[model samples]
Target: MTLFIGFLIGCAFGAILFLGGATSYRRILGTLLLKDLWIIKLMATAIGVGTIGIYALDFVGLANLSVKPVYIGGVALGGLIFGIGWAVSGYCPGTCVVGSAEGKTDAMATLAGGLVGALLFALAIPLLSGALIEPLSFGAVTMPDLLGISGIWLALPFGAALLMVAFVILRERAS
Candidate 1:
């Protein structure tokens, strides 16, 4: 049941991405170049809604929020790699999948490359555990923890701020 629900949600999300033009290489490049705000607005809305929904579920005892451990080196390296890949390929993992679904060859290649990268990272995890994961590790914590406030309290304002950015601050440029 959970798997089925997840599949349905994934389908809905993919449809949304498609409708929002996130599947387009041009759109991705425009975003990277700061000429298009559509994808940024879409992501902002998603994160805003997700933040509110996840915290609401947790508050009501319907979900358990499991925070991942933070490793500075691992995060910095991963972000650098992710940004470079996005800039070079114009397709992040999610968008690549959606583009592949649309039968885009470039997206297919990007997806293949991403899979290879993931495999390499998995294989290198053992070696990275010492240098990147342990020494810099900060046990599972969240912004609320750092600020000494309940997640719901921070989530409300943060989510609202993102929502405002998506709906009010950002405007789609004429193509």
Candidate 2:
């Protein structure tokens, strides 16, 4: 049941991404160039909504929030790699999947590359664990935990701020 629900939600999210032009190289490039803010806005909105929903579910005892460990070096390295890949391919992982579904050859290549990258990362994890995962890891701590507050309390304001960023702050450049 949970898997089915997750699949349905994923389908809805993919459809939203498709409708929002996330599958288009031109649109992605425009975003990278700061000439378009559509994808940014879409992502901000999605994150805001999801954050609030997840926290609310957890608060109501309907969800279990699993926080991942935070390691500064790992996060920085992962982010750098992700950004470079997105800039080079004009497709992030989610968009690549959607674009491949739409029969785009470039997207297919990007997806393949991403899969290969993930496999390589998995294989390297054991070797990298000491250097990347252990010394710097802050075990499963969230902002709310650090601040000694309820997640829902922080989530409400943070989510609202992101929603404002999406709907009110970010604007498309005149092009």
Candidate 3:
């Protein structure tokens, strides 16, 4: 049953990516050039919505969830690395995987880069654990939890923000 559900979700995502033209390196690179960010916006919205929904469900007692609090040093380091890599490669890891599905050879290179990045991280973790690795938390930790607000309450703003971003991205493409 779990396998079937996973397959269905994967298929749904595949169809979405196929229809959205997200599997193209041109579209992914467009974000850097400020040409077209439609695909990037769509993916970001999907992630934001999914995250909000999961948190909402957890608040309602319909789902289980857990999130470790943000580690500033790790977040900063990772963001710097990711930003540099994306700017240099013009394709982030997520976009690269989708592009590979649509036959982008550059996407294949990006995937290789991702693997290399992961390997390097693994290798460095042991040496950096003293300052970088934080202890894991066992239960849900979100904006609402951190701010002492309701999860569903936070969801509204998150969803709205995603919609606004999508609108802006789409509007730019339309113009």
Lowest-sum lDDT 10-residue window in model 2: 166-175
lDDT of 1 by residue, 82-163 (tens): 9998877788899999999999998899999999999999999999899999999999978889998778888899999999
**Candidate 1 lDDT score relative to the true structure:** 0.89
- lDDT of each model, Cα atoms only? 0.89, 0.90, 0.73
Residue 120 shift from truth in candidate 2, angstroms: 1.5
Q: What ranges in model 2 sit over 4 Å off?
A: 171-175
Candidate 3 lDDT over 95-160, as tens digits, reads: 677677777787788888889989999999888866775653223446666798777787777787
Better of 1 and 3 by TM-score: 1
When summed lDDT is taken over every stretch of 10 residues in candidate 3, the lowest stretch is 133-142
TM, every model: 0.93, 0.93, 0.76
Q: What does each candidate score in C-alpha RMSD?
A: 1.5, 1.6, 3.5
lDDT of 3 at 26: 68
Sort all candidates by lDDT, best to worst: 2, 1, 3
